[model samples]
Target: MEKSAVYHRPSDNFAYSINKTTLQIRLRTKKADVQNVKLLFGDPYIWENNEWQIEEMPMTLSGSDDVFDYWQVYVSPAFKRLRYGFKLQSDADTLIYTEKGFYETAPLDTDFYFCIPYLHQNEVFDAPDWVKNTVWYQIFPERFANGDSSLDPKDTKPWGSEKPAVNNFFGGDFAGIIQHLDYLVDLGINGIYFTPVFKAYSNHKYDTIDYMEIDPQFGDKETLKRLIAECHSRGIKVMLDAVFNHSGYYFPPFQDVLEKGEQSPYKEWFHPHSFPLTGGERPNYDAFGFVESMPKLNTANPEVKDYLLTVGKYWIEEFNIDGWRLDVANEIDHQFWREFRQEVRSIKSDLYILGEIWHDSMAWLRGDQFDGVMNYPFTTNIKNLLAKQSITGQEFIENMSKVYHNYPKNVFEVTFNLVGSHDTPRILTECEDDEQRTKLIYTILLTFMGTPCLYYGDEIGMSGGADPGCRECMKWNEEDQNLDMKQHIQRLINLRTNERLLANDGEIEFLLPDSPNGIFGYRKYTEDKSIVVLVNSTDTEKSYSFTEPLSDIKDIYSGKTYTGSSVTLEGYGFAILNY
Candidate 1:
């Protein structure tokens, strides 16, 4: 037995309250090392004599990655607390694993077991339920459309007439978005995540000049309210970007600090290292990555916190927005986010709070701060697997399994999953303009767990590199768009909307292949039904045989019926099977 590989903890993803009464505990062991595991658990106080009474529940092998096999079991303690340990059996030896150390036999003292101090209902990760069913469409407002050319900024070019640049503007407004609400509806998008729409100096609007006012380039507050009403009327949800991390140089408060230095009442709102602030190769004061124009706000300040909290609540209270995607969320203090979540959610109990974090965000997702992060790890793995072709199918499955096990099931369900975004290269560009590979990427995205988001022009096969290149004007002409790609994504969204299992409804078990580059897939199943999604990343045709015989199997994508244990797919092909 590999004693070093056996691991468990009594908090976070390992042991967490799934609901008011149920506690789900998980254990990890080296891959293929352990033959079986049984969870020995009981209330800490439930003891008849001095023996410490307990019950044994066999832990099921939930999933496995490259290095570890994860096992899980759900138990409800009568006393709302638990003391648990594991009895792990390998081919050669059996050992009892607990908080203390490996023991030859189960220990009677509860002190040796891991403890879940108490299971409070509030501790259960609770995100907006509507998020799971949503399919998000991200829009860079300046490039989406030019509905009213009258609202165009000075020197605004004709829509899609030229390439995009950091300073260029094409006058995309709420009127433009409102004009195309039906287009998104046809694509089966239920949620729209617009990049910063607040008044700012830059075209991207990340540097907030005014949090309370809508950028004139995007139209007035009434126009935004009308857009929200139109979206809600059509069964769509609106999520606005909140750039509270920093303020633009042109912002009134920031300009005052730059002018007054120490005498400015708002000087403490920012992080100024010394008097006489100057901007050059590096700013004299702390800023967002030494950029003089974008100054990081000191969120720890009471006045700054109050102002931001008001900005957070004003949108929900006034415009009835459904969500807020926090910018630079990881850099901010956790206490502010806790208060942000409380303040915003108090007004709208179901308002979704998403954070823009590109890495592991377990620290911010403990039911106290963010409901979910941007899920950049999932994006990196997918891009490497299908787009870059740097990783094989087996490696992709293993990598994704690690991402899946990093967070609680509920947190993963509502994560903001995306492939191409305003910050990354477009999916088609990432796949080197190959429509087939792009289609496969969308297949994995829309069919996988969590709410998937499609970048503004991705469905129509728009291709561009990172940053300014990715923020092109939306193609309005059907002749200019890739109809096939659009149809393919539209169908996938339909399947996701109609089928509950596809959208975080059941447990997912990844199917690992023998060879590193071989065919691979995952099975999302419940007690009554199952869905097996297979992907063939190679150029030649590939076949995958199911371990168990499948009867009355139907391909959800093609609507073809077949009864068999094996299935074949062409190069870059995917199958969504239902039986």
Candidate 2:
């Protein structure tokens, strides 16, 4: 046995309480190394006559990646406490594992076992339950719509008349969003995640000039409140984007530094490499990448921390916003985020806190910092397989397996899954204008675990590249829109909201077929029913044979009933089969 490859922890993703009583535990071993694993667990205090009451339960192989196979088991301790260990039997050796280390023999002492002294309900990773059931719509405030022409920027141009540029604005405002509430409601989206709407000089609003005020072009504080109220009246939730990692060059504190240099009282508010502030080809201090206009905030400073925390509290307490989508969240300090969570949750305990992190985020998702991060890895992997066709079905499963086991079940449920965003190319364009391929990807996204978000105009078959190109004006004219694509996405949204098995709580299992080319499949199942999603990502038609008898199969998309064991799909085809 390759014992060195084995890994487990008593807390976090490896083990966590799914509810008040039920605890889920996971173990990782080298791929194809262990033949079997049995969990040995019992309450630490449950001892009688100098013997601890223990029970042994076999663990099932849940998933695998390139290097590891993950095993999982669920346990509910009668006494609300747990002391557990694992017994592994491999082809070459047998061993016992615990919190301390691997042991040659099973130790009778409870101290040697992994411990969950008592499962405190408060420590549980509790994000809002509503978030898991939501379908989010991400709106770039500057490009969504223009309701009030009076609020248009001085240089505002005609909407959709020209391609987007770095310094151009199309007069999209809060009134525009308010004007389109019915449209969004018709599309069946319950949550709206708006990119930074605060006062900023740039069109995207990432560089924050004032965190307290909404951008003039986007409307004032009152306008935002009205928008939020309107959304709430229709059962929709509002989440505003916050950029606290840095301040724009025109921000008061940053401007003070530039004007008075070291003499300014707010000198410590930012990071300055030298006595005099300098901004040229590169910043003399820390900033967001190479942009000197956005000076990095000194979050460690007490004053700066207090100011940011106030900003975090203001939206939830004053405006009654549902959540905050933090920009460049990975760049901020852990302590600041912990305090931010405490302050914000103090007002609204159920408010969702999502981070804009593009990579591995296990550190920020331990039930303390963030409810979940933007699931960019999910986006990348899906793009590689479905859009680019660079990976096989088995490889996609392996990649997803790694992500599946990276966090506790609660965190995974709230993950922000998206195929395209303000930062990426449109989904249809990524699929080379192939509507079938785009629909297939959306099917997987909508049916998979986590909350799914759709970029504005994606449902109408809008196509563009990244950045300036992706931020196109919303096409409201039916003549300019693709009605078929819009209807397809609307149907998906309805299915996701109305179906119980499609919700975040469903158990998902990826089916790895023997054939590696063009086909990928998985099933979202519960004790009462199951839904299988299969997709063929190639140009040519494909055939798949079921490993077991699939009885009473009905495709939700096509309403085609199948009683056979095998099925065939047309080019770039897919199916959502219910059994």
Candidate 3:
């Protein structure tokens, strides 16, 4: 046994409450190093005749990746408290793992075990149940479509005619999105996550001038209400971006500060360091990354907190929006989010709260704050192996394992997983225009755990580099679209929505190919059915043979049947084998 590789924490991903009565415990060990694992658990105060009352149960091999095998068990303690430890065994060695450390035999003293003092229902991270079944379609509202030219901005250009810039608008509005409701319905998407749609100075709408109103370029409040109603009519959920971290330079409060200097009533609303506010090279106030055009708000102020919380609750109370994708949520204070979650969910208990965090966000996902953060780590790993080829297939699996283990199982299930968004290059462009590699990346993304998001135009092979280039208007012309890529994406979306095993909380295991050059595989399984997805990233024919002959397998992707153990795939090909 690799003692150094063994690890467990008291209360986190290692141990957590799945619900009010159900507690889940997990352990991580070096892959294939331990032959079996058993869990020892009991209520901390349960004792008789000076001896602790304990119970031992065998742990199941839950899943494995390149470097670690995860063991898990679910327990419901009679007293709603737990003190637990693990009993690990190998072919040649046996060891007891407890809170104190590893030992030759099980510790008789219960003090040496890990502890969960009590199970609190409110502490369990509960995201929206609908998110588990959702396939998100991310829309950059300004580029998605143009329905009412009458509502177009003064300088709006013809759709798909000009290159996208930071300041230019293509007249996309709620009316446009309203016209395309059937289009999204036909694409098999249940959720639509729009980039910032509040009143803002920029075309992207990230710099919010007002959180309470829809951008004039997008439409009026009633127009947005109609759009939301239409989306709901078609069984689609709408998630709007919330830019509470900062306000645009044109925002009324910031303008007042600039006009009246320190004497302004709204001076306390922002983080202005000096009396006379300046915004040339460096603003006197704290802003989003030194950009003077956007000023960060002082969320610590009671007034600011109330105003932001009202904004958070207003949409749910008014339009009945399904979720809010917070912008730069990591920069804000955690207390504000806790209050925000409480306030928003008070109106709609199951309302989804998503954050725009790019790194580890364990602090913000404790059920009192955001439900989940963007799964940027997954995106980074996927891009490295499939896009840049900077890492081998094995390296990708190891990195993915780290990501999987970084958060609690509940948090991992609702994470916003995506390959492309407004902040990144299109997926096809990331693959350097190679359709086959792009397909493989999508196969991995759509089939993997968590809620997957598809950026508009990615399914049709629209190619561009970052930011302004990636935000180009949607190419709706049949002559300009990649029909094959679109169809493949549609199929993947259908599989993700219909397959029970592909739920956010399914048992998944990564498989290693005999030759680990450019092949990767994983299986999503339940008690009823199992699926093995294989991707060959190399530019040559690849064949994989099982250790023993296998029967009763069907390829879901290509609709082919196989009865033998061996399978051959073309260069950059992918197959979903169902058994």
TM-score of each: 0.98, 0.97, 0.96
Candidate 1's residue-wise lDDT over 1-579, tens digit each? Answer: 888988888888898887898988899999999999999988888789677898999998988888999999889998898899999999899999999999989999999999988878877888999999999999999999989988899999988889999999999999999999999999999999999999988889988889999999899999999999999999999999998888888889889988999999999999988988899979987777888998999999999999999999999999999999999899899999999999998999899999999888999999999988998988999899988999999999989988888888888999988998999889899998989989998999999999899999899999899899999999999999999999999999999999989889988899886578777998899989888888998777888887777777889999877677778888998889996
The candidate with the higher lDDT, 1 or 2, is 1
How accurate locally, in lDDT, is each candidate?
0.91, 0.90, 0.87
Task: Name the TM-score of candidate 1.
Answer: 0.98
lDDT (10s digit) by residue, model 3, range 422-480: 98988888888988889888888888889999999998899989999999999888899
Backbone collisions counted per model? 0, 0, 0
- Find the candidate with the highest TM-score and give its number: 1
Clash pairs, model 3 backbone = none
What's the candidate order when arranged by decreasing lDDT? 1, 2, 3
- Please report how far candidate 2 places residue 265 from its true position, in Å: 0.6
Q: How far off is residue 248 in model 1, in Å? A: 0.8
Model 3 global lDDT (CA atoms, 0 to 1):
0.87
Off by over 4 Å in 3: 30-33, 48-50, 61-69, 90-92
Off by over 4 Å in 2: 91-93, 103-105
